[model samples]
Target: MKQVDLGGSGLNASAVALGVMRINGLDSDAAAQQVLETAAGNGINFFDNADVYGDGECEKRFGHALKQSNLQRDHIFVQTKVGIRDHAYDFSKQYLLDAVDHSLQRLGLDYVDSLLLHRPDALIEPEQVADAFNTLQNAGKVRQFGVSNMNPNQVELLQHSVQQKLIVNQLQFGIKHTGPIDAGIHVNMSDPRSVDHDGGIIEYSRLHNMTIQAWSPFQYGFFEGVFIDNPKFKQLNDELQKLADKYHVTKNGIAVAWILRHPANMQVILGSMNQGRIAQMAAGANVQLTHQEWYDVYLAAGNNLP
Candidate 1:
């Protein structure tokens, strides 16, 4: 896997990261351990997880499986998210503190490499969040801080008061979830494409040297379904297959390659629990698409350049 500077945090992270959101879906703990080993053997050293995934079963599985694997904790990067509840969001100082402590306990770790606020809390008090971050950092519970599904302005709001530099923003982005790219390419046009749905987050992250970790790199339309191999996206799949043939990788790998081809230097998080599938998709990080090939794949996905 290709290594990129994660949020310019001075940590070299694999461009292709394994997301353990569905790890609990595996039939057994041994299978989960195999998943981690396969990913590590394939050069993926970054892992993404959340408190709410599988209602914490995913983290538990990952932690248990990780202990069973041969890879050591310091050899990989682990990032987890918090703040989302049943019907509300919480980023209060106490909530943030307790949440991270619970996450560490579940993961069986003293500290995580990075911690992220899973979503924007409407009633967030930036100072309280800053205090939580300070406490975590002071106690050696977290090494880095970030946000998820937040617009640039929202990020700035917290950055304004938070002493620690916010270095990452996780978002839903892929060949299908192209809102960030669309808003940039459409520039002054009067189409929906021109609407900045993410408050120019893509550009903002680039300008600020913040890493944008792309989650659900294969899904389309708010988890409607994956577009790869689906009859509804025959043309797109065909294009992907052609590129896959050229690169000697799977069509699924091509989808990941397309996201890696962007100049934004983003990281891709794979949600696959199957070892073979994980290796195939992580292979995409190794193939660099040409400029024309990148746009060709983009256009085939039912998009047009303004």
Candidate 2:
């Protein structure tokens, strides 16, 4: 459980944070409390949730579980997303403000540690969003702000009109899906591999001091089944297992280590509802995979070295 500064914010967050998306299905309140206790015991102080996850059930569960726990509110960093409703994205000033308020009520909190725009809204007006963010910041509703599933240009658009700095960009990253790394390695050629798929998000985030949080660290893609132990990803899993054995850790931890090995200072968001799974993944923050082992896992994932 290594702690890292979340962008320029004074608050320090764990390198591996807990994602509460799947906690809505927990059979009992005690079950959810056990998960939270396990995560906190491992020094994971950052808890991520969203207004739309399980239709806001997850957020309410977290708020209740925290209240029952002995842990104080200030000891944790809680983040939730906005701008998404039903099936559409909404970043309009009115929607953004209303969304935060709803999230606050559901979570039973005065202010969110950080509020992120869930995704890019095609009709986004940066100035309108800035006004909402400014008002929220002044009213002590939100301490900081950021975006999720957005590329460089989308972030730049917000920066153009917003006075507050964009401090974090949460993206989907895993060993099986390495498009961000692949696009960078194959840049600038007539070949399709050279095309930028992410709009140079990785570099832009690094350049702007925006922390990149890796969500779904084990998924094949977009909530698809995890690649761990899947026959389709046998080679990659083989290498991961070998490294896990070397480090005396579980294979899941090795999967997390692959992302932690990156120099981007990325944080891993684990969406598991199982407490044991979260503990296994948290161990990766302490296991520094060797340089060779890191690149070996990369090649196993079928990415070209160039």
Candidate 3:
């Protein structure tokens, strides 16, 4: 696996991050451990988790697996999110403090390598969030801090209060979910792609050296379904197959490679639970697509130019 610096934060991990949001479905601790081993063997040292995933069951299973495996706590990178709640979002100081403690308990670790604010809280107090982060850092609870599903303005607003650099902003980005890319290319145009959906977040993140961890890389329309093999995405799949054959990788692998080809420098968070698919996608990180090939797949995803 290719190693990349995470948001110029001096934290480095594989280009691919194995998200454990779905691991709560594993039958046993051993099964969970098997998943960990497979991901680790493929050079994926970074594992992504969230407090609300499976209502915290996913974190519990991940902790159990880590405890049972031979892998040490310090060798791999563990990052988890906080702030999502039952009916709403909470970034209150007390809530964040308690959440980190609970997450550490579930992961059986003293601290997470990185902690992300899961989603933007409409009532977020930057100073309160900063206080929580400073307290956690002083207590050795969280090593680094970041945000998820946040736009440039939101990130800038929050970063204004925190001492730690907001290093990562995980967003929904891929061949199909190209809102961030669309708004950039269609500049000064009248089409929907020029809507500036995210406040030019792609350029914003790149300017700040913030790593954009792309979640749901294979899905379309906000997790409606994966377009990898869906008949509705026949043209896209056909192009993916063509690239896959050209690169000697699977169609999914081509998708992963396509993401890695971007100069914006993103981290791909894979959601698949299949062991073979995980390894195969990780292999794609090693691939570097040409300029023309990259745009070819982009157009194949049904995008239009101005």
- Using all chains and alpha carbons, the TM-scores for the candidates as numbered come to 0.99, 0.97, 0.98
lDDT of 1 at 161: 96
Worst 10 residues of 1 by lDDT: 1-10
Please identify model 3 stretches exceeding 4 Å from their true place.
Answer: none
The lDDT, on a scale of 0 to 1, for candidate 1 is 0.93
User: What TM-score, to 2 decimals, does candidate 1 have?
Assistant: 0.99
lDDT of all the models against the reference? 0.93, 0.88, 0.92
Model 1 residue runs over 4 Å out of place are: none
Q: Whole-model lDDT for model 3 versus the true structure?
A: 0.92
TM-score order of candidates, top first: 1, 3, 2
lDDT (C-alpha) at residue 188 in model 1: 88
Choose 2 or 3, whichever is better by lDDT: 3
TM-score of candidate 2 relative to the true fold:
0.97
* Candidate 3 structure quality by residue, lDDT tens digits, 42-154: 99999999999998899999999999987778789999999998889999999999999999998888999999999899999999999999999999999999999998889
Worst window of 10 by summed lDDT in candidate 3:
66-75
Write the residue-wise lDDT of candidate 1 on 180-223 in tens digits.
98988999899989998889998899999999999998999999
